[model samples]
Target: MNFKELRDLFIREGAEFYNQEEASALFYRTLDQLLGWSRTKAVTSLDKYIEASDLPKYLEVLEKLKSGQPIQYIFQETWFYGFPFKVNSGVLIPRPETEELVHWIIETLKGQNGGSLLDIGTGSGCIAVALKKSLDGFQVSALDVSVDALEVAQYNAAMNKVVVNFIEADILAYSGTESFDLIVSNPPYIKEDEKPKMHENVLAHEPHRALFVSSENPLIFYKAIADFALVHLNPQGLLFFEINEYLGKETVEMLELKGFKRVTLKSDMQGKDRMVSCSI
Candidate 1:
């Protein structure tokens, strides 16, 4: 079948489960993966016909989508902060909001001397790796409790050709011997009570431990990190977090209680308060 025919087939068969546009896009994305073609190349070359043997793979992917698997997982890779990163069930997928957080970190630290930087809960090492790639003369370390997540993160670090110190330790329980010039985290902040309100795409596909905090203490990671920063961050060092949009005020308060100065809460592109930066 030609590209146009396969696109039509996906839309006709899976359009009810996935929207027309999304189903169509999925078709092209899968074809691009199989053929290693750019989108423009793939679409403009519609006259090229697909082999009969490739039909089964296309149908299989469509059925998986019908069952609600995320397209990124289906593709087994995703682009984050303009870098290609591998992802799977072991780690939470890198998100656009988190990209904004990374962008904010880069912009905030612009023209500044780079020293030691640490990322807590460094799933896939996205934040740590992105920072190391963007900043000069910076020492970067990333920590995560899950060994499996760390493995994926290390692979991503190597793939991106950026060196990041990957440490396996629970940030909450870690004893720090070295102070850092900057510390950043995008820790679990979604409260259990708020889970029902989140989209199924997130609650179902993403790792829950990376998404949620106990309802009794929605600010657990924030408090832990703040306390750590108080003792482990160098004087005049900065702390950054990608916060729960619903609890920006609480995050700011947590930093203030820890005596972090110049606490600033910033909104993401959607105008939700999603990040906080504070200085010691």
Candidate 2:
């Protein structure tokens, strides 16, 4: 079959599982990645023949998508902050809102550096590596409880040509004397019960350890990281968190009760409280 036919097939079949725009975007992006055919080229060369060898792989991926697998998992890579990250079932797919958090950190430190920064629960090393790439003068390190997740983070650091010290340790048990000028985390903040509100693809494909926290104590990671910051952060050091939207007020209260100063909660592009920053 020709390219147009394949595109039509995706629109028709994928609509059964996903929305029209989502299905089209996934199909075109997968095609571009697999065959180096841009959407414009696919459109202009409507009659371009599908390769005999490539069709099988495309069909298989489409089947997986129909089965509610995330496209990023099928591809095993995603772009964050204009850089590529290798990802799989072990890591949470990087979100655009987290990019905003990174941008805020970079903007906050635009003219200053030569200090250390730590990314707690740094899945895929996205924050740590991205910070290193943007702030070459700063030392960057990342820690995660899951060694498997750390492996993906380390690989992404290498792929992005940034050096980040990767540590395997639970945030609750971190005991290093090393201090940092900044500490940041996008830790698992989704409560266990919120799973029903999430898309089936996310629930099925993403690692639960990288996505959930207890409903009773939704700020579990935040509290641990904040406590760690109290001990390990240099004077005037800042702490940043990508937070749960529903618990923004509670998160801010926890940080303040922990004696953190200048506590601030910021919303994402969608205007939901999604990030917090403070200093001690």
Candidate 3:
């Protein structure tokens, strides 16, 4: 089939699960991934025939997309903070909001010569790797509980040619003696009841441990990380979190009660309270 035929196939098939615009976008993205064609090229070469070998791969991707599997998982890769990282069902796909959080950290430490930073629950190691790549002379460490997730994270770090210390430990039970100049986390903050509001692809493909918390105790990870920061942060060290938009006030209050000073809640591009930064 030619490019137009392939595009028509994807749009028609993908429309069952997504709107026209999304389906079209998915078609172009698939073409880019499978054929290495830019959108401009795809448009200009609409009559170009898809190789027989490549057609089956496109069909398989369409089937998965129809099944509500995210394209990132279909390709086993994603771009974050302008850097590509490997992803799978074993780890959460890094979101654009998390990129804002990374940019925030980079901006805050822009002039600093060097400092140690820890990324808790570093699924895919996007934040740790991105920060390490951006910051010169900074020692970066990432901790995750899942061996599968850690393996992916480690591979991503090496793929990006950055060294990040990966630790396999549950943050709740971790008792490391190391201290850091800055600590950041984008831990699971979605309440159990909120799952129904999320897209089926995310709920189905993303790791639950990296996306959810009990509704009764939605801030569980935040509290634990805050307590850990209180003990392990250097004097006046900084702490940052990519938080749930709905629980910003409660999170800020909890941090304040825990003796974190200068607690500042910030919103993402969407104007929702999605990040917080503080120092102790």
Candidate 4:
């Protein structure tokens, strides 16, 4: 089939799932991936014919999308902060809010030198790798409780061409002796009760191990990371968290009660409270 025919078919088949524009974009992106051609190339060569064998491959991907699987996982990759990272069901896809948190950290530590940072529960190592990439002469290390998640994170670090120390240890039961100048985490803060409120695409495709907490202890990861930061963070070292929107104030209060100085909660682009930064 020719590109035009395939495009028309995709628009018709995808109409039930996505709008016309959305389906067009998805089709072009998928075509770019399968054919390794840019959108401009795909367009200028619209009359080019697709192989008979390749038609089934495109159909299968469309069916998966119709089934609610995220396109990033379908491609086994995603771009974050302008860097490409591999992804899968084993790790949560990096969110835009998390990118904002990384930006805030970068802005806060601009012109710093050789400061060590520890990323707890670093599922995809997006934060850790981005920080290391932006900050010069900075030391960055990340730890995750899951071996599968750690594998994905390690792959991301390598793909981004940044060095990040990866450790396998659960924060709830693990104790840290190594000190860091900055400690950061975007831990599992989504409460179990909130599951019904989340999109099925997320719950179905993303790793729950990296996403949820019991309602009774939604702040469990934060508390554990904060406690460790109290001792392991250097004097006045900063601690950053990408927190749940509903728990912003509570998270700040927890940090303040822990004697962290200058506890501050920040909102995302959509004006929702989604981040917390404080000092030990």
Candidate 5:
């Protein structure tokens, strides 16, 4: 079928899962990947027929979309902080709120000459790589329990031409001699019971270990990371976390109770308390 027909098919079929605008955007994105055509080019070539060999690929993508698989997973890559990173079922897809957390960190440390920073549970290495790319002076390290996720993170670090120390260790049991001037984590904060509230794409495709905590101890990772930071953070070092919007008060209180000073909870663009910063 022609490009216009394919585009129409995407809009109509994708409507079951996404809004019209989102479906259209997805169409253009898939076209760009398959044909290397810009939006303008795709629009201009609407009447051009898709090659028979490429038709199956397009149909496959449509089927995956219908099945509620995230487009990012279908492509096995996504953009974050203006850089492209490889993603898969091994890691959680980087979200926009996490970008704001990165921005907050950069803004908080803009004029500093250099400092050490660690990203706990650095899925896909998006946070660590983005920080190292933006703040050239800072030494960045990332830790994750999943070796598969670290592999992807390592590839992304090299692909982005940024050096990040990748550590395959669980934060809950990690003991490190090195201290950092800053530590940040967007750890798993969603409780197990919250799974039902999440979209099918996330629940079915993303790594469960990277997205959930036991409902009995929803603050499990936060407590462990906070205690780790208390020991490994340099004097006056900063700690930041992208927290669950529903657990902002509890998280902030946990930090305060742990003896962290100047704990500040900040909301994302959506006005939900999604981040917190504190100093030792």
Candidate 6:
């Protein structure tokens, strides 16, 4: 079928799986990308017939969607910070809230001079690449525990034409030689008990290690990162985290207890307390 027919079919048959608007958007976006057709052109040619050979690909995508797989995974890439980033089962899909976190760091470090910046859990290297791209004057490096995630991150760094030093090490177990001017992380802040509360799209497709923290120790990564920063960050250097909305106050408190000064908690566009920044 043509673009309009496929979208209509998706909306009707996939209503139980996705809302009308979501299904419509996913179907059209997928069609545009798979067929390399402009939306305007596809709209005007709604009545045109699609080839029989393309039907299998359409049906396969629909089946995956019906099973609650995220469309970004099907596409194998996502746009973040206005750049195309490769993603897969090994990494979490970039979120709008995280983009806000990256923007905050970019603004915070723009005028600062010749100091190294470290990004923890740099899945897909979206934040690290974006920061280096925006602030060419600063030294940027990123580390991840998963080698698979680092491979994708490295590819993304190359794809974006940004220089980000990538390290394959768990931040929890890492011992490095250098100190940083800034340390930023968007770690696995979701507690295990909160998994059932998440959308099927996330729980079903995203990497568990990249999305979860133990319910018994919700601040595990945060505590480790904060302690690491206390020793690894220069005096007056900043520590930033994209936090779980439920634990904003606790995160800020943790940072303060680590001897960080000027702790600040900020909300994202949805007004949830999603970011916390502090200085050593």
Candidate 4, residues 1-280, lDDT tens digits: the string is 8998888887888776678898888889998889898999888887988889778999998898777788899999888888888888999999999999999999999888778999998887888998889999988899998898899989889888888888899998888678999999999989999999987778888999899999998999999999999989999899999999999889989999999999989999999999999997
Deviation of model 1 at 227, angstroms: 0.4
**Candidate 3 residues 86-163, lDDT tens each?**
999999989999999999999999999999999999999999999999999999999999999999999999999999
Q: Rank candidates by lDDT, best first.
A: 3, 5, 2, 4, 6, 1
lDDT leader: 3
Runs in model 5 with CA error above 4 Å? none
Per-residue error for 47 in candidate 1, Å, reads: 4.6
Looking at model 4, residue 269 earns an lDDT score of 100
**lDDT tens digits by residue: candidate 5, 138-212:** 999999999999999999999999889889898999998889999999999999898888887778889998989
lDDT of 6 by residue, 1-280 (tens): 6767888988888787799999888877877878877777667877888899888898899888888888889888899989899999999999999999999988887677677899999999999998888875889999999999999999999999888899999888988989999999999999999988889878888999999988889999999999899889987889999999999989988888777899999999999999999998
Error of 2 at 206 (Å): 0.2
Instruction: List clashing residue pairs in candidate 2.
Output: none
RMSD of each: 1.6, 1.1, 1.0, 1.7, 1.1, 1.3
C-alpha lDDT score of every prediction, in listed order: 0.88, 0.90, 0.94, 0.90, 0.94, 0.89
Per-candidate clashes, comma-separated: 0, 0, 0, 0, 0, 0
Candidate 5 has which clashing residue pairs, if any?
A: none
Q: Give the higher-TM-score candidate: 1 or 3.
A: 3
Give the Å error, residue 271, model 6. 0.7
Question: Per-residue lDDT for 4 in model 3?
Answer: 88
Two-way lDDT contest, 3 vs 5, winner: 3
Provide the clash count, candidate 4: 0
Candidate 1 runs further than 4 Å off: none
